[model samples]
Target: MIELTDNAATELKSIIDKEEKKDHALRIFVAGMGCSGIQYGLALDDDVKEEDVTVESKDIKIVMDSDIVGGLTEAKIDFIDTPQGKGFVIDNPKAASECGSGCQGCQ
Candidate 1:
């Protein structure tokens, strides 16, 4: 239920391969209360509870817990390394206003 870019998948795989302990999947979801309104979060988790929905993106498995603040379907996750630093950039179409990078959900 999600689309992941090549760069994003690669970046995510590298991270998972590093931190994952028991074949855990990378969990990505959006939560309220950010500088704009929503912010993206990423974490390496090993527990996939019953309510979690798992989606395959290339070689990476992303677990989505519907009970979370919201869903991340049809979202592209990218890891960009700038001269300053690096972070996960999310492009979400569900957002309402322009928050980052001239997109609806850029934060």
Candidate 2:
């Protein structure tokens, strides 16, 4: 199952509150393919299609397409605040394992 870290949930809640998107759910989807395998993107979406799977974690609703749910199994969403920047990050072990030493996108 996909999970969201405490930091992620807190940050997301803040954004949702600021944006006044109380009805919107966080949508995760395959954004593209990289050397590390599939890359994911997150957005606030109010639309839920028939093929979508929705779950609640840390009081946040997460929505994903059924097709990509399997690939996201055991994945964790985190928020990082480093000197470089701060943003949401998805840690998917399956995708990381698919990465080779030559991966440039992950670097």
lDDT winner among the candidates? 2
Poorest 10 consecutive residues by lDDT, candidate 2: 94-103
Off by over 4 Å in 1: 20-22, 68-71, 98-107
After TM-score superposition, the amount by which residue 52's alpha carbon in candidate 1 deviates from its true location, in angstroms, is: 0.7
> What is the C-alpha local distance difference test score of candidate 1?
0.71
Clashes of each: 0, 0
The prediction achieving the highest TM-score against the true structure is 2
lDDT of 2 by residue, 1-107 (tens): 99999999999999999999999999998898788778899999999999999999999999999999998888999999999999999998877666676777766
Per-residue lDDT tens digits for candidate 1, residues 34-92, read 53556768877888888888888787888877765254555777778999988778787
RMSD of 1: 5.1
lDDT of 1 at 67: 66
lDDT per prediction?
Answer: 0.71, 0.93
